[model samples]
Structures are given as C-alpha cells and as structure tokens.
Target chain A: MTTATTTDLYPTRGTAEVLTPRQDPVVWGAPGTTGPLRPSELGDFDRDGFLPVDALIGPEDVARYHAELERLCADPAVRADERSIVEAKSRDIRSVFEVHKISPVFAELVRDPRVVDRARQILGSDVYVHQSRINVKPGFGASGFYWHSDFETWHAEDGLPRMRAVSVSIALTENHDTNGGLMIMPGSHRTFLGCAGATPEDNYKKSLQMQDAGTPSHTALTELAGRHGIRLFTGQPGSAVWFDCNCMHGSGDNITPYPRSNVFIVFNSVENAAVEPFAAPVRRPEFIGARDFTPVR
Target chain B: MTTATTTDLYPTRGTAEVLTPRQDPVVWGAPGTTGPLRPSELGDFDRDGFLPVDALIGPEDVARYHAELERLCADPAVRADERSIVEAKSRDIRSVFEVHKISPVFAELVRDPRVVDRARQILGSDVYVHQSRINVKPGFGASGFYWHSDFETWHAEDGLPRMRAVSVSIALTENHDTNGGLMIMPGSHRTFLGCAGATPEDNYKKSLQMQDAGTPSHTALTELAGRHGIRLFTGQPGSAVWFDCNCMHGSGDNITPYPRSNVFIVFNSVENAAVEPFAAPVRRPEFIGARDFTPVR
Candidate 1:
C-alpha cells in the first residue's frame, strides 16, 4: 500500500517520532450503497493518471453549489484577493479560493459525501483538502489555460511532498465544444515535464509559452501528442474529472457565448502532506496555497 | 539561523529534490516603524519556551471579537458540530474551529497585523494558522485543566514535523486567580514528552489527566515540575500568551463569580507545515485538525 512517508533530505529533526500515527484505509458508504468504483471505472486513471466522474453532484446539488459559486465570485473581496483573476474583456471572475470559508453552501460542497467517499477509496484512508478553487471561463473570447501539469507547480511552488494527490473538477456549467474544454495527452503523467521559473503572475496566460530549455520543450510534448493521442474532457453540468497531479494538461480559449465554470478541489493523501515549497523565494498567499491539512470526515 | 528542516524518519522519498528553496527571514513590517523585537524581548521564548504579551488586541478590538465569539457560540450548527464543548454546570462554550471560515470578524482576527507580524519574526518566515479555538472557563467553579505540551498532541496525532509552532491566547475576559488561569512549567519544551494514545475527544478536559505508558509518566513530569517552577498566566482583557507547542502547560477550573474567555490560535512556520496524522486508523476531523497550511500575509 502506498503511504505518506517522511523524506530524509533535511538534517535537523530530533527523532523518528516525527512520523507517527499511520493512517488506515477508510471504507466508503454503507456496505451496498457504494463500496468502490469498478475496475473498469478506474482503468483510465490507472493507465492515463486521470478518470472521468459521472453524476457526482446530481442536478439539484449542482444547482445549489453553482449558485453558491456565483455568489462567492460576486463578492468584491474574492476578486480583490490575489487568488481571483479576470477574463480581461469580460471582466468576470476567473478563479477564487477558500470558497468553503465564505459561503455555508460552498462549505457543504466541500463535505459532500459523493466527493469525499470516492476520494477516500482512491487515495486510501482520510483525505484533506490541499487546495480549492473555481476556475471560471467567461465566454465570448474568455481565456483558456495552456499545457501544464499541476504537480510541477504544486511540488515546486507549494511543497506538496509527492504525487499522491488528485484534483476533482465539478463542472458548474456545461463544458462543451467552443467553450474550451480540458485536453490531456493519455499517459503523459509518466513523463516528468521539467518546468523553469515559477508560474508567472497568472496561470492561464503564462502557462502557454512559459517553458524553457530545461522545461517541457514543445518538441517533446508534440511527440507525446502524436504517439499517446490527446483526449478532450467535455461534459454536462455535475459531471467531474479526476486527474493525477502529474498529468500534463491544458485548454484553449473560449469564443462561445456560453460560460464554463468548474469548482476544482485538490485532495492529497493525509500521509503525503506538503512542506514548504522548493520552487522560489516568494510563495503564493494562503488564498492560493492552503495551510490547513485536517482530513474531511 | 535556526530553520525548519525535516524529520529523520520514513525512508522512501524518491529524490533529494524533495527538499528545496530554504525559507528566508520575512520582514515583519514597514522599515523602522516597529521592527523585530530585541533579543531581550524574546529571551523568555528562547530560554523558557514561552512569551507573554501585555496587550495585543486593544480594548475596542477585544470587545468586538468577544461579541463575535458569543454570537458564534449561539450558532446551532456550532453547538451541533463536534468541535464545540460545554463546561457542564456553566453550560458555556468551550471550543470551536473554522471560526475564520464562518465569521468575517473572526476571519479578520486571523489576519490581525499584530498576530501575523510577530509570528513571522519568530518562525523566521510567513506562517499559517494550524489550529484556532475559543477556550471558555466560566466562573463559579468552572473546570480547569492538567499539564501537557501541544506538540505532544500535534506530533503524535497531526504529523507535524517539528515544534516550530506557537499558540497565541488573547484573553477576552479578565483571567484572574479565582478564574483558574493557565499554569505552565517555565522551560519544559526543551524535552520531548512522547505520547501514545490519541489526544482525547476534547482538549480542555483530557489535557488535565491524560497520559499513559508510552507517553511521559506523571512521575517524570512531577520531577520536572519540582525543578522548573510552574507559573500562572493571569491577565486582563486584551492580554495574550505566546507559548511553544512543546511547552508543558494546562489551566485550572474557575470557581470565582467571574468568567474567562480567550481566543486561542496556533501558528506554525510555513516551511514546517503538517501532513495527515500517522498515529492510527481514525483521525481528528477537519474542524479539530485543519489541513490548509496557507501562510497568513
């Protein structure tokens, strides 16, 4: 069983007592309600480092959470806070953080049984929210993020210990053609796409042309695209995608009138918790890099 | 030059790249307005493992925060959630968490300049809130606590790497002798009081009489108590106490007619952030053991 272990890289710790109380695998739902996903369901994730989640929130819950997301995004502070970004032309909220901290409804979404129960099955034992945000693509030429893997930034910038983490993106609105849906190269996670310099101020713009000599060269990613094949993650509202942190992925700009908003949450194994980041001198604010590591019950 | 490094245990890290980008000493405030404290100011924290702040939150701010605390105590969900506890006879609120996630007022307190600046200086960089609670000791014979160190609970249960953490308790009401104020051993943090069982359901009580074989024995603690005299932390409204997470400490019951309420927050160095607990199968819920490690700016 893969577990969160300690790194011996640093030299000053006093004792082995530092790594105590190993976590136990948690059973999900009632015996029959939902044990775990079928092998077929996780096949893609096992091979490609990501999986698709269907009907996670259902219609009613999706509506509720979507409304909450909108309300939180409307809050001026969300935009003012460093975590929020705008789609220049549309002037709409592009991303927001600690939504669970602001709205009681969003807080409920963070604890939704549908999400929590499944996450436990995949990661084993209890899982704590490493990071939570709503990536909003305001339509009619709204921005789309370019190719990048989360772990590259997470490990380098946020200090996440290992790749024992995955992200769940619950589409608040339909993400279809013309709206710039997510795209990933099957099995690209196996390759370590080295990154250079910290992700520039904003993620969407900088990610596209940010690579350097040591980073993922366009030539290499192009080869993987031809060999492994690229897949599109387009779905209806309430549908979700769970991707490994190491998977190289990105999306194109949206020119459709329809907007695409998805609540993205990164869940890390309690065993694989993070330390201080190794990437740069300045770290992102709490709105960006979470500080609390308590597991969700 | 003391910095937060890694624990020596757990041997499976894949790379030396696991640890990178050492933490820098963050400047607390504008140049010269009020710089870091002098060596003498932190003499107690360095020598005795604790420091006392005479007036952190001003009377006006304390009044405001105290009002917010009472309002939250009345929240139905707050009472229903496992985090809140009552003193039995007094029926007063004992503890609560995610207060910053709920109330905007409490959220502001989480970012209070006074609390953040000093914590950064001591921690040597940006710091994040590890745990936050309101401990209430209602008068007329309200309950008091026994002795124990925070790191004992944090390390054994929460997987914190080092004791690079501190607790700030700001008195909302006057903490007097009759009210069963906090009592702590002067320099107990230097020694590690290993614990076995998980920290009990509630901190206010179990802390008073909790410990077993694998943990530090009472007989051993008694000897230390004799050598290092215990000091009572009693003060007026707005006064605060900053103590090392490893310091042996606890408080007493309040038999007086007066009541004592305080806002207690735990701050850990960003570089020394935590992972999921390692102690056992089940773990503390998000309310009790937070997972977010975002440093407060």
Candidate 2:
C-alpha cells in the first residue's frame, strides 16, 4: 500500500482539511462523474500544455445570450461616465452580472460534468472559481490588443495550485473563420510566451519582428494554420470551447456585420491555494439562486 | 496629413472604438498618447515582456477587502454543498463583486487613477478586464503548482493577445521571503521558447546538479533577480508587481500560520482585434456600480 509520507514525490498536506472540496462527482465520489482523463488527453496536456474540450455549450443558449447582450447594449442604463470610462469611445459596460444573472445555460456550461471531472483528475482538490465574464464585441476598428499571458499577472511564490486552470468560452453566435472566430497557435502555447504584457515595440525589439509583419513566411505553424489543419473553432450558438488558461488564442475580426459575443469562465483548484480577486468588483443579484456558494479566501 | 492610411500601426477595432470617443481628450490626443513609451518601463516590459504597476489596491482598501473576505469565509450560510464542493477541506468562494459594491474602499482600489494611467501608457486605449479574484492559500500540503506560463493553456500562436495582456497583483499583506513571496525567473520572458512549460518530470530529468531536488529553477533570468542590482520586489501591502504573463514564475510553501492573500487583475485592449479570456472570472462590482461607463472595446 502506498502509505502517505511527507517526503513522498507528491507531498500533499496530508490532512483532509488541506483537500479542496470536489466540484465534479466524476472525479470524486459523487455519482455520474466520468472516468479519469484519457491518456490522449493527458498526453496532449503534457506535450502542448493544454487541450480543447469541444461542444461544451450548444446553439440555443448562444442565441439567447446574444439577444440578452443586445438588450444590455441598448439599455441607456449602461452608459460610460468620466471616472469609470477607461477608453475614448469605449462605453464601459461595467458589470454584466449585475444587470443579468448568468443564464441557466451559462451556469450549465460552467457546471459541466465532463469539465469538472477532468479538472478534478488534474487539479486535485482546492479547485475554485478564478473568474467569469461576458465580452461583446461590436463592429468598429479598434486597435488590436497585444498578446500576453494570464499567469504573469498573479505572480506568487507560495500556494499556487497545481495543474492547468481551465478557461471555458461559450460562443453565443455562429463564429466563422472570416467573421472573427477564435484562432490559436496550436503548440505555441507550450512554446511561445505569446506576448503577455509586453508592448508591441518591445516585442518587436525582442523577437526582431514587427507586429503587422505577420508570422515569418517560413514558420511551420503559420503555414499550418494557413494551409493544412488550422483548427478554427467556429461554433454554433451555445457551443462552448474549454481550454487551459495558458492556451494561446486570439479572435478574428468581426468582418461581418453581426456582433461577435461570448461568455467566459475560468476555474482552479482551491486546496493549498492563495488566490485574490484579480479585477474590479461587479454586482450579483441575491435571488438565492445558486445557494451554498463559498467565499473568496 | 497623417491620415489613417499613413499610420503604419493602428489600434484594434475595440481600442479604436474606445479612442474614437476620446480622440479630442488632450491626454490621449496627439503627442501625449502618440509618443513612444518610457525607456525603463519599456525595457522592463521588453526584457520580462511586462511590468508591475504599484498600489493597485491601496493599503486601507486591502485591509477592508481582507475583513470582508474573512466575513464571507466565516459565514455559515456560504458553506460548500455536495455539487459545488471541490476539495473536502478547502472551500471555494464566488461573486466577490457583491461585497465590493458596498465597500467604497474597494471601488477606489479598482479604479486607482495612477494604475489605470500607467496601464494606458503601456497598453494603449481601453483595457479589457480579463479577470479579478482574491486567492487565499490555507496551509495544505499540496505540491506547489507546476511551473508554467499562463498562455500555455490557450493556443500556441506567437502573435495572439496572450502576448499583450498585463497582469497586476496588489499585495494585501507583507509577503516576506520566508512566507513565500513570489519568485520569478527575471528576463525569462524574452527567451525564444526556452525550457518553459516543460513537464516537472522532464524538468527533474534536466535539473541542475547545484539545485535542490524537486525545486524548479528557471534558466534565463534566474541569476538576474539577485545579481547586478536587480531587485526582487518583496511585495508589501499597497505595492503591486506586474510582469509578462509569459515570465517564468511559481510559488513556495506557506509555512506560516496565517494565509497569504493578494488582489490580482489582468487587462488587455479590446479593439478591432479579439482574444479569448484566459482565466476564470471573479466578480467586478465596480463595473456593475459605475453607470454611463463606456465598455472599453
């Protein structure tokens, strides 16, 4: 029997108190939970550091979210003020959670059994919600955001959770390769740093390449995304794509007239963890809807 | 005349939208916003691919957030349930924006003018709130989280916004060397896909003889943080640290009795370009409270 030892390769906190509550029944003792992550998934995660779990959300939900988003955008209540306004033409759509509670579809997407189970198998206890939000992109020429990473922000020396924290994006519209669908760099997430927090000039200097210069015509991955199997996740409404938070991804332009919308949520284990809120606060209606929620540590 | 066509580099659609409304504002108009970024800040960002802005959360605000966190943790009504629980002993928290709305202190911290201005300087136009959350690590014996970049979980594209996003962490308490302050591989962010996101087992197989077993060490900037006057920000309450999301970073054990806490936020410009959310979402009450705020494209 593998006796629990402090010096074991996987040195755990030993006490049950140190363990995080299991959110997915599949990994824990809860019934109807799935089996352990497949070797293929593990191998992908190990080699690429992430994998995309498909069909997380469906089409019907996407339509609903888009409609609700349109309503929110039209509402005069969601105006940008001086203090809250961070951009020139950007109308601050403060907190969507206040104006709208997560649709049941959104909540279902978050509480997906397969995802929770997979997280449990990889992360092991102490899993917690890192953040969730809805980003609605309207038509207009905005300067493209620079590339960057999520982990670079919350730098910590102790109490960081093991395994990849999962970030799930639910498309509320039919995203196509041309109409601002999500694009990724395949294995680049495990290789390239993806310009987290650096300026374009700095990136140019460091990489010796200009931002618009485009990936070198010689690069294999660029060629692959361009010619061969460049996987573009153009999902129907409500179709969700779940990936590791560190994955390298960017959105295509809304070249089409329709607005591109999506809801995102990230989750991490809570055990032996030290996490703080990373953004400004938003309001949540107290409908006793989602009961027994834990507080941020 | 410097028409749009003449400008080689332009802002993203989201960024452009944000800037469109403020094109007349002196701060963002002409020379002020058009000039190149500061050398040192740019260097820091270039070398590490990111920089940390200070006082992301004021000292007093940190104190209040701590208090509210304590109340939420202690509240019996917020206990984890069967489905939601992840770790048995560790409890997960959610929806902090609700509490933040009531506390003017947190509002001020989130909208800290200085931090926002710096962010604008670094990442032009409107900054999108990628995520926000407070993490508390109770002394659990879980192995320290693996060493990896945040963007590794997403796609592998080299030019994705994962490269441009900046994360800011406001230390709520004094993080000492012993108590597990953040450890970073200085300048590691600039390496050409060096040994980052490597498996722990692979890293172990390649560990340096002089290094301690199982303790991960980065190669690029390891020696720089301590040598040549390179300072490690042993972050104190009210002080914030920012770095490239791709910068090599990890945490140590929280051997102390008290928990480690901090407020972290990731920002990106939303313009004509699009990128998926990398991490989980924590609530932003300030976004909900501030009406008439323009949504940063």
Give one digit per residue, the lDDT tens place, for model 1 in A175-238: 7643567877777776655543344444433332333212444555556666666676878999
lDDT for each residue of candidate 2 in A1-297, tens digit (9 for 90 to 100): 798522211122122211122222112223333455676665665455355555554555556667766665556654331111122245434224322233454455455565455665555453545555566654321112222233322211122223245656677665543334554445433432211121232222222111221221223333333332224566666666656544444443331223456766656655423332121121111221112234222
Who wins the lDDT comparison?
Answer: 1
Best by DockQ: 2
C-alpha RMSD over true interface residues, each candidate: 30.7, 20.5
For candidate 2, lDDT tens digit of each residue in B1-297?
675322212122121111111111112212346333455666566565556655555666778767765665555553332111122234343223322333455445556665555555556567655444444544321112334444332112112233445567677666643233455556555432322232232222122111222222333232433332122356667677876555555544332223456666555445313332112122112322122223232
Give fnat for candidates 1, 2 and onward, in order.
0.00, 0.00
Give stretches of model 1 more than 4 Å off. A1-297, B1-36, B88-91, B196-215
- Listed models, DockQ each: 0.01, 0.01
Q: Count backbone overlaps in model 2.
A: 138
Model 1 chain B: which ten-residue window has the lowest total lDDT?
B11-20
